[model samples]
Target: MKKFKYLFGPVPSRRFGLSLGVDLTPFKTCSFDCVFCQLGRTTNHTTERKEYVPMDGVCNELNEWLSTNGQADYITLAGSGEPTLHSRFGDVLEFIRTHTRIPAVLLTNGTLLDQPGVQEAAARAHIVKVSLSVWDTASYVNINHPHPNLKFDQLVEGLIQFRANFKGRLWMEVFLIDGMNSGPNDVKKIAQLARQINPDCIHLNTAVRPVHHDFVKPLTGEELNSLAPLFDPPAEVIPEFKTTRRPDFQTNEDTLLEMLRRRPCTSEQIAGALGLHLNEVSKYVGKLLRTNRIRKIRKDDNVYYCTVNK
Candidate 1:
């Protein structure tokens, strides 16, 4: 079986089920070094939107996939890097719409929304899910650690602009880090932003998977649920993280090695790719390292796997 470097998931989503994720920017390239980011640290942090990957190449690949699979719940633009960082984001959205009837969604950190070009690009998406980690500037700096050039005021303005222009649903995602954005004041500020943006829904999230910062912890469900009522109706905490059980979807050691050749993956990432249990994937990865099919790289005590050819 062939594994894709760019396309991942049809994984479980709290908002959209079985989302087929498309990576627009290069791996681990992003504007923020968020405390709760699932992908770990940002190796390259910049606000500039460049042609990180050949837009036409990615568009062509996406067309082929959509043409074959037809549609899933949502065709999401998000991957290891921030999607808006791709200068040709508008073209990508247009390309997807031209080829498929599936609703296109752009999942972004919302830092770039203030840019006229970014706003123009986002106008084409069927849904926009923007991340707002904290309400105040200090909290913003502490929690998200966004690009030095990004301003919280501008971010808030841009989010409002998106709400004004986008006809589709606007879903706001708030990631609460313990003792940081989970307090009463933080919750109040977030609630104010929610009312201002007036998104279709607000999703309260805690770090469930391993993250870039060792200090970040997932808030208790009870803690998250407490913040739900502050926003307007339809605003609530994420229900639960659910995994699908499909026995037919399976990957072997050889298949896993092939995937590592293209991208470095943690045990969790490998499991996500294969749709297998983490413990099961960890056992296979451990075995492969002993055989020297893969090499291990340690960053901040976290292990990542990459292919090593003999």
Candidate 2:
């Protein structure tokens, strides 16, 4: 199969179900070099918004996928880097809206939400989820490591303004890192700011994979559960859910690798999704682990296996 340059997954997202992904920006091209970014440190850190990649190429791949009867819960504007960093991101969203029945979704860091163009573009999505990981500028610097040109206040203002007029479902994702912004008082203040945005709901998440900094740590389900009520309403703990139900397939490492490329999966998740026994999953997983083809990440109570670039 010829690979789509700008299109990637109908990956299973715990929050968004099976979602077809659109990568608008080049790898690591983002406004914020967040400490807990699983893709590691950002190489191209900038606040500049332009056509990062050819927008027509993305639309072409999307049209091809749709032509083949691509099925997914959502057509997601998320992959590799922040989608909004691309000036034509709105056009891509518009393409999905006019071209398909599947709803479009934007998973953004909320940095550019204040820009009039950005707000107008993002409003095209059926659902937009923005990030709110810090309460103050200091904490924003500590956790998100935003570009020097980007101000924490500007981030808040943009999110608030975007929410004020967005008719679609708005959601806020609070990424909690231990000893960083997960403290009770910190969450309380963060909650106050989150309420100002008035999202339809909030989804509390933690770093599930290895991060750029050692200080950033993933929270336990218990810790996340305890912190859920700190928001206006309790937040749903992000968990690895079944991506898709498969009929049956023999144990294949390539199949496992392809699945992990989409989203991290537990041994049981791999087994259940692939219709393999736990022992069979362990065998392939162990081989991949030794070769560094895949890595293990502890998410809540489960051990997840995900693809590694190296």
Candidate 3:
């Protein structure tokens, strides 16, 4: 198979199925520095939108991949950063819609959803999923740590506006933390607010992978079940990660997973052991990390990877 710079996975997503991810922005370029982000801290925290990765490069890679008749459940616009930060993301979605039968999905933080341009571009996707975990500005700032320019009221207004106009499925996710936003008062307030926007489905999620801060904690299955009934339509918990690859889609990814299943290893250690280049190993490792198949841990100076159940 040809190596791709702009595309990764047929990642077995618990929500979106076999999702082929499109990366439009540089790493960690986002509007929020979320406390529970699995990819770690945001290096560039801003709402600035630009052609971070040129549209031509992304389209060229997509054209090549599509020409081979690659299959996926959804062509996802997401990666290490907020994809909407790329000014030309709608054009990419247009390309997918024009050329293929596969549906598109947009995963966004909902901070920029207030902007008309962002909302317009976001509508191109068949299903749009936005994050809303807090009830007020104080909780939003505490958990999401959004850009200074973003406001909670504007975000809610934008979401309500988008829901009125959007013809596609709009899914809202509320990420609950142990002591931060999972209490009866907080959850009840958030549930009340969620009813106003009125998404097609509400998904309750908790951190299952390694997070940016040690204090960030997850809610247990029982605890999550207890909180589900608070929403107007009642929320469903997000499931654990899984991937469905094609029959011809055998790669070093399988070997790496098997290797990590026995013991944890760093990226460098993985490359050396697998007889593969460090750069080549990163894509597969990232896919594994994103899907929650394997997790990273910091030990002294080195970070290591092991299966999530470990």
Best by TM-score: 3
Pairs clashing in candidate 3?
12-242, 12-243
Per-residue alpha-carbon lDDT of candidate 2 for residues 205-258, written as tens digits (9 for 90 to 100) = 886644545677878789999999988877778765542343222226678999
Give the true-structure RMSD of model 2: 7.4
Write the residue-wise lDDT of candidate 1 on 1-310 in tens digits.
1345566655555677656777887757888988877666788998888988888788777877766764468888887689999999888888878888878899999889988889989988999999887887898888888889988898999999878888888888888888877887878888888889888888887765545455777787788887778777645877643332332223365678778998888887887887654423544564565456787777777778888862
Provide the lDDT at 161 for model 1.
85
Best by lDDT: 3
- Candidate 3: C-alpha lDDT: 0.83
Put down candidate 3 lDDT per residue, 1-310, tens digits, no spaces: 5657788765656678677888887777899999977666799999999999989999999888999988888999988789999998889988988989899999988777788998899899899999889999999999999999999999899999988888999999999999999998999999998999999999998876556576888888889999999998999987754433544334567888899999999877886796643433555675677677898788886668998987
RMSD of each: 6.8, 7.4, 4.0
Off by over 4 Å in 3: 241-254, 261-263, 266-297, 301-303, 306-310
Candidate 2 TM-score, true structure as reference: 0.81
Worst 10 residues of 3 by lDDT: 241-250
